[model samples]
Target: MDRLKYLLSPIKIRNMELANRVVMPPMGTGLGNDDATVSEALLAYIRRQAKSGAGLVVSEITAVHPSGSVSPTHLGAYDDRFIPGLRKYAGAVHEAGGKAAMQLHHGGRESFFLLMQGEAIGPSAIPSVVYRQPPREMTLKEIHEIIDSFGRAARRAREAGFDAVEVHGAHGYLLTQFLSALSNQRQDEYGGSFDNRARFVIEVLEAVRKSVGNDFPISLRLSAEECIKGGYTVEDIQTILPRLVNAGADIIHASLGTHGTPAGITSAPAEYEPGFNVWRAKKIKEVISVPVITVGRFTDPALADEVIARGEADMVAFGRQQLADPDYLIKAKEGRTNDIRICIACNQGCIERLMLEPGSSVRCAINPETGQELIYPRTLASTRRKVWVIGGGPAGLTAAYEAARIGHTVSLFEKEEKAGGQIFYASKAPYKEVYDAWIQWLIFQVQAIGVEVKTHTLVTETMLDEEQPEAVILATGAEKIIPPIPGIDLPLVCDAFQILGDEVKPLRNVVIIGGGMIGMETADFLIDKGCAVTVVELLPRSPVKKFASHGYMLHKRLRDGGGRLLLGTEVVAIREDSVVVVSEERGEEVLPAEQVVIAVGTRPRNELKEALSERNIRHFVVGDASGPRRIIEATEEGARAAWDI
Candidate 1:
C-alpha cells in the first residue's frame, strides 16, 4: 500500500509555519463559560484535538462583539478581559505542538434569543426564516463600528498568542449578509452591485490585516455561492476574489450555504454522495491565487489526498469526520484508515445538539469523548482490568474498544452472527453508506486492540459467571415499537426494521405509519425502488422537525421527492391492502397500499438488564437497553461506563 504523507507535511502561511496540513476547521462546541470567556472545558476540548496531531486547531466561532454572538455560551473575542483565558487556551494548543487560530464572527439576524433583547442588525432590514425576527438595517456609523470591532478582536487574538485569525465571512453571518445580494439589498455603497456588496468584507480584511500587521496570517472564510435563490454565485465571487486577495487575505477558506433556507448549506436527502462540495472548491480555486481550503463531506482520506494532489484545494477540512475521530489525520498518516472511526453523517448528534438542546455542547455519534474531555479524560487507569461487553451495537462496540485501549482484557458478545445491531438496518437505507464506514472502522478498532469478539453467542448469567470479569457492560440495544392499531398483525403489515433488514419484501405501494427520520428515509429507499409511498404522522410537523438546521434541509428534500406527506394524521387501522388514517383537518382518509410499515418509535431491550440485576453483579447498562435514543447518547454513555471501569 502507498503511504500518504502530504497531509502530514509542513505548510507555511505568512509568518506561521504549521507542522502539518491537517487544519481543524472552526466548529461551535458551545462550551464557553457563563461570562462568555473560554472555559477550562473548552481548553481541554481543543487540547484533545491538538494532542490527536492536528497541525492547526481553529478555535470555535468566537463572537467579535457581544450582539454578534450566536449563543450565550459561545466564546467571545470582543473584550480584552477575555484575553487571559484565551491565552491559556493558546498555551495548551502550543504545548501539544499544534498552532492555534481564532475564528471571529458576527451572528447578525441569526441571533436566537438575543434578538428579543435587542434589535437584530443586518445590511438590510430583512427577516430570517429561522429566527423569524425582523432585523434593523445597519447605519453607516454602525457598520464602521462593527468593522472596528473585528479589528480589535483580531488584535486581541494576536495578543493572546494565536498564530492566525480567520474572519468568519461565510455561513450567512453578518459579513456574509453584507456580501450576499439576496440579503444585502441596500442601494448604498455597501450593497446592490457585486463590488458594493464585497466592499464591507474587503474593509474587514484590510482592517484585520492592519491590526495584525504584515507578518501575521490573516485568513478569510468565503462562501463561493450562497446556494440560495437570487444569491451570489461562483461568477459573483470571481469579481470579489481579487479584491479580497488584494485586501491582504493570506488564505481563502471556501465553503457554501446560508442559514435562512436549508438549500446549499447541507447535503439534501436527495444528494448524499461523499465529497459533495469539492466541485465548489475546485471552481473557487480556479479563480483565486491564494491557497483555498474546502470542506463538505470530505470523509475518505484517499479523496482528501486527491483533492490536494490534484490542486483542487490546498487544504481539506474534515468537519463531522474529524468529530467522529480527532485522530483521523494521525491514523491516515499511519495507514490505519480502516481503524479510524468514520462519521456516519447522522446529524442526530452534531446538528441536533444545538437545535434540540440549545446551550449544550456538540458531540459525535461514533466518538464519545467529544466535548466531555473534562469529565472523561482520554488517559486510561494504570491498572488493567477484565471487561465484558454484551451486545454488538454501537454502545457495546464503543465500550469494548475503550476498555481494550486501556490495557483491559475485553470480550464482546452478540447474539446475531454479525455486529452493527440496529445500525445494520439503518445502513440499508439509501444514501446511508457513511454508516457502513463507521461500523467497519469501529469493528476494526475492537479487533485491532486484541479484544475477543464472539458472534452468534447469547450472553447469559452462566457465561457471565464463567468469565468472572471485573466489569460488565450491557448494550443490548432496542426493538421496534409496533403500535396496537387494528389489523396491525396482518401479514402485509411490517416494521421499518424488517424492510431495512431485507426480512420483508418491498411492496408495490407502501404506507409508512410514521413520518420520523427512519420512516422518511425508508420512504426514500422504497420510492427510489419504484414503490409509491405515503407517510402519516400524528404530530403537527414531521418527527424530523426535531432535527438540526441541516437535518431540516434534508427533511425538505424528502418532502419534495414526490412522496405523499400526511402530517397531523394518525393511523387508526391497517388493512391487508389499505390503511385508515384520521386527521383533524381531513376527517378520515383511506390510503391504499400493499404494505404498511410501522416506524412510530422503539423500546429499550431490558431483558438482559433484568438478568444482570438478579445476579447482583457489578454492571452498567448503556445504549438502547438503557433507553431508546440516538447513537450519540449511546456512544457517550458507553465510553463513560468503560472509562469508569
Candidate 2:
C-alpha cells in the first residue's frame, strides 16, 4: 500500500482546510504564566509543532468557565481577557501554515487544585476514585449555565480566530461524566438511560453550534467505551452517534477509558502494541458518516497512514509522539523519518509533570527544546568551537549532538565501545525494547551531526589537557551500588545491571533485592526468560513509589507475570543459593534462588569530576556522573551544559 496516500492528501473540514491528515491533539502543556496568560514560550512551542507540518494544531484543554479549570496556569477560553493571547496563538499557527483549533473543556470532578479550590463539581454527587472526593451535584439552573458557558467559550474561540472548536466530552471530564452511568448516577434529565446520560453533552454541542453558526466546524471528543463495567460501551456510543450528529457534532473524535480507573485509563492494553487505539476508531468510523479522529499511541507515521488508508480514521491525532518530536510531520514529509525522535512511551517526563510538577510545564524525553522553544532554536552559530565530550551515554550523546549542531567540532568518547549507558540494561526488560530505539536514535543523531565518535577509548584529565581546544563535558555516568549484606560476595550473587547488560547471566530461580523500578523490571525480564523471580524490598510499596502512573502500570505487569513481590521486607543475608529476608509483618523468611540479583539503586561517579576539579579544567559533569538521576534530568543537564559552552 502507498503509505503517504491519504496522509499527504489535503482535506477540508467545513471552512477550515488542512494540508494533511495529521493532527496535533490537544494536550495539557501547563506552560502558561501566572494569571492564566499564554506566554511567548507557549506560543513558540505551538508554532514549532505547526511549522513541523501538522495539518492542524489543537491548543491545550482550555477551561470554558472558572469552575472548569484544572490547573491555575492552564489556558482558558472562559474569559474575554484570554482572547488576545489566544489570538496570538492562532496567528502563530496560521503563520506556520496550519489550522488552529481550541479545545473547550470542563474538568468536572477531575478539577485538581484549581477551579473549585480543590473541590470537584459534576452532574451528580458521585465521588471519583481517581480524586477520592465527591463532586458537588449540579442543579438544573447550573446545567443551563454550563451549557451557556460552552456556547460563550465557542464564541470566544471564534473571536480568537480559531479555525475550529472541539468540545472535550471525553476522558471522564464534565461532559463525559454526564454521559457515563458510573459517574453520573443522577435521576434528573441528565442521567439513568443512555439518552438521558448523553443529554448534557448533546445540549452543550447544540448550544455551541447555535453560537458559532453552521459554517464553523464543531468537533466532539467522545469516549467510545469507558472500559469500566457499568460505563458506556461501543454499542452505546454507536447508538448515540446519530443523535450527536443530529445535535450538531460535525466530527466525532473517538477515545477510550475513564479517569476513575487509572489502570483502565493508563494501562488499558487492548492490543499492547503501537497505535493500539486505532481499532476503536475503526469501529466508530464504520458506523458514522462524520469524520472520525483516533488518538492513543499513534507514534509511527506508517502506522498512522495505515489507519487513514484503511478508512479507520479520517484524521490521526498524535499526543505524546508529537510531544517527543514536534516536527515529526515535517521530517516525514522531507523523508527524514530516521531523524524523527520516537517517543518510548515512558510517561516519566510528560505525564509526571502533570502530577508532581504541575506548574513547571510538560516536556519531551528526547526533545529538550519542547517547552523552551522561545529560548532554544534549532540553528547553528556564526562561529564554530572545538568541543570534547567524554562518554557516549544519553547525556554525552545529547551534548555532543547539540554542540555539533551549534557549529562546534565535537569529539565524543565512549570507553565501552558503545553508547546508552545504564539505559542499555533498562531496555533489556520485557516490553521495553522501545527504549532501545531511543538509544539508537541518540547515537544516530550524534553521528549525523558530524560529531567525531571514538569508541573503546578512555578520556582522562591528561587526554583533556592534550585535546584542550575549548570545553570538556564529563558524562561518565553512574555505577550500581553493591550493599554489604552478610555473604553478599557469594559466587551465585550478581548485580541486576550486570545481568541485564549481558555481562553476566544467571541460571534460574533468581532473587532480586530491592523492589524498585529496575528490580521489578529485572524480575519481569527474568520471568520472561523462564526464571522464577522474587523481589525483596524494604519499602512499604517498593521504591516504585517514585515512578509515574505508567511506570506503576509496568510494575503491575511484572507482578502479574509470575514474579513474587515481597514489599516491606529487608534482605539481611545472601546465601550461595538462597536469600534471608525480614518482613515487617511476616517475620523472617528464607527464599531459595539459584542466583541473587541486587538492584539496590546507584551512586554518582564523582571521581571524574574530582579529577577535573583538581586539574582546573573548564568542565561540567552531567547525567549519572553528577548524580544518579533519570534520563530526563541527564538529557536536560547535558543540553544546558553544551549550550552554555
Candidate 3:
C-alpha cells in the first residue's frame, strides 16, 4: 500500500464507494453443481478472493437465460430459486469486507449447443466455431423476452444482496453479437447501424436499471477492442460507449478480444505483456464519465498503480492473478511481495482446466489450495519428521516449503549456486518472465517456514547415509534429449537450456533443431536478438499442443521476424554450421546455420533413484524425475509428497 499508493486509494462508482481501487474481475469457476446451483465449494472459492483485499469482487458469469448457457449446470440467476445461493455469496463477500457484483451472462452463439440442449441463439443465424454450428437467430419476441430476463436477473441479484449488477456484454455474448456488425446482420431494427446493432444491450441495460432502480449501481462489460482482423476496433467501441452509458451503464469494464478468439482467450496469455488492455481501456475512459475497470493478466501491483496514475483506467482488475494467490493485494500491502504467489500465466489450471473439459472445476497450477480453500489445510502438523529434499527446482522447493510448514524439519540441497534448476533458464524467456517471481515466492515460502537451504552442495549416497533422514525427496529434474545425431556435440550446436541461460550466444543465421514450445521460445528469443532462424519439427502440429492460446501469436512473431517454421520436418543431421532436414514441402535440404540449437525433448534424471536404492534409502521421486510434464503436475507431486511424508 505504501508503494502502490494510487492503487490502494479508494474509488467511487456511482453511489457505491470501494475501499480500494483493486478489483477481482469475474473468472469462470466450475465449482457449482451441474444443476445451476452453487455449492459450498463455490462459496469457499469466493471467500478466498473476497478476503484478498480487492474492493469489488465480481462473481463469475451467471446465466441470465438457460438457452444461452455454456454448461447445463453453470451458475445461474435466471430464476428466483438462485437468489438464496447468490445471497450467500454476496453475504460472504460483505462479511469479508468486500463488495460483490453478479454478472448476468447469455453466451448466445458462444454457448455450447449440446450443453445448452439446443442450437445456440444469437441476433442472427451466424456460423460459430464456439457453438460448433450456425446459431438460430432470435425472434423479435424472444429478444424482448431476453431483455426481460436480464431485468429479472438483476432483480434477483438485488434480492440476493449484491452491491451491484453487471450485464455481460463482452467476450462474444448475445449482447456482443448484437453489437458486432460481422455477426449481427439482421434486416430489422435490431441490426444495421450502430444504434440498431447496439439496441439489444441498450434495452437490456435500461431494463436492468429500471429493475434495480436508480440508487443501486449497474456495470456493463464490453470488448473494447475485438483484437482480430476485421473486428470491432477500439475506435468503434469509443463511438459505441456513449450510447451504453446513456442507456444505463454506471460502470464500464473494458475487456479484450471477441468470442471468436482462439481457445476462448478472452484474457491475454503469458506471451502477452502485462496491461494488455490498458490502451483499449484508456480509450474507453477518454469518452466515458463513469469509472472504467480494465483486466488482462494484471499481476504486478506496480503496473496496477501506474495504470491508475497514468489515467489509463480508474481501477485495475486481476483475474488469474487473484486466482493464483487470493491474498495477492494484501501481501503487496503488507510489503510481503516476495511471499505473494505470482501467476505464471500457464493457464493450465485456472482457464484451461475449466475450459478443457465439460465439467472440470477451477484449479491453480502454482497454488494447489485455490478452489479447495475450505478443504485444504494451510497450517496443520499431523506429525514431525526430518525431511531431506534433493534438487532446488520448483518440485524440491515446493516439497521443502510444504514439509517445513507442517512442522517437519526440512533441508533442501542444490548442486548449483541458485535454487531454481530449469526454472532459472525458463524464466529468462520473454514470455515466461513471470516465473521469476514465482520462483522467488517459492524460495520465500521455504525460508519463511524455516526450511534449511543448502546451495552449491550436491547430496550423495554418503551424505544420505550420514544424515539418515526419515524422508528423502528426489526432484533432480530433466535434461535435454541430445539425439544420437552426428555433430550434435560440436561447439556451434547447443541445446535450448544452454541457449536460454546465456551460455550460448546468438549468431547471424541459426537453425533450431526442434519446434516445440521450448524450441519456439528459443527461436523467438534468438530472432529477437536480430538473428535469422529456422525451426524444424517432427510433429505436424508441433508447438501448438501445450501452449495453444499464445502459440498462434508466437508463431506469427516467428514468421514476421523472418524466422522459418517447418512442421512435419525431421532433423536428419546437425553439422558444425548446418542442419539437414527432411520435410514434405522441401524433400531433403541442408539449411545453412552458424549455430544449431536443440530442443527436441527431455530425459528424466533418475540416477539418484538408483543411487538411493543402493543405500536402502526411503525416498520419493517427483516432478520431471517421475516423468516429463508441466509445472502443474510437478507442483502437485511436491504437495502430495509433503502431505504423504
* Candidate achieving the largest TM-score: 2
lDDT of the candidates, in the order given: 0.81, 0.82, 0.84
Per-residue lDDT tens digits of candidate 2, residues 1-645? 454778878888888888988888887888887777788878888878777678888888898987888888878888899999999999999998889889999989887674346456898888776667778898899899989999999999999999999999888899989998888889877888999988998999999999999999988988878887777788888888888988888888888877765554532332257777778888887677888988887777878888888888999888788888887877876677888898877765676667567567877767888877876746786667788888888899989988888888999999986877877887898777878888998898899889999999988767866766477788988888999999898998888888887888767788899887778778877878888888888888766752355465657766667778888899999887799999769999899989999999888875767766767777889988888888888888888888888
User: Which residue runs does candidate 3 get wrong by more than 4 Å?
Assistant: 1-6, 12-15, 113-118, 129-132, 262-265, 309-311, 610-618
Regions more than 4 Å wrong, model 2: 1-3, 114-119, 263-271, 377-383, 546-549
Clashes of each: 0, 0, 1
Find the number of clashing residue pairs for candidate 2: 0
Cα lDDT tens digits, model 3, 487-573, are: 888888888988898987788998888787788888878878999999988988775553356576668778889998888998888
TM-score of each: 0.93, 0.96, 0.93
Total clashes in model 3, counting residue pairs 3 or more apart in sequence or in different chains: 1
Worst 10 residues of 1 by lDDT: 263-272
- For model 1 the TM-score comes to 0.93
Better of 1 and 2 by lDDT: 2
How well is each residue in 1-645 modelled by candidate 1, as lDDT tens digits?
A: 455555656789999998876677888888899788988888888888777677788887898988788778888899999999889988988999988999989988888767777667899988776677878899999999999999999999999999999999988899989988777899889987889988999999999999999999988887778887788887888777888988989888887777754533542232455667778878877777777887777666777777788888888777777777888777777777776776766665665566558777877767777877887745667888878899999899999988887778899999999988888877776667677767877887789889899999998778776767777899999888889899989988998988887889998888998888788778877876778788899998876763364345546656666778899998998887899999999999888888999899888886866666777766899988898887777888888898888
Worst 10 residues of 2 by lDDT: 262-271
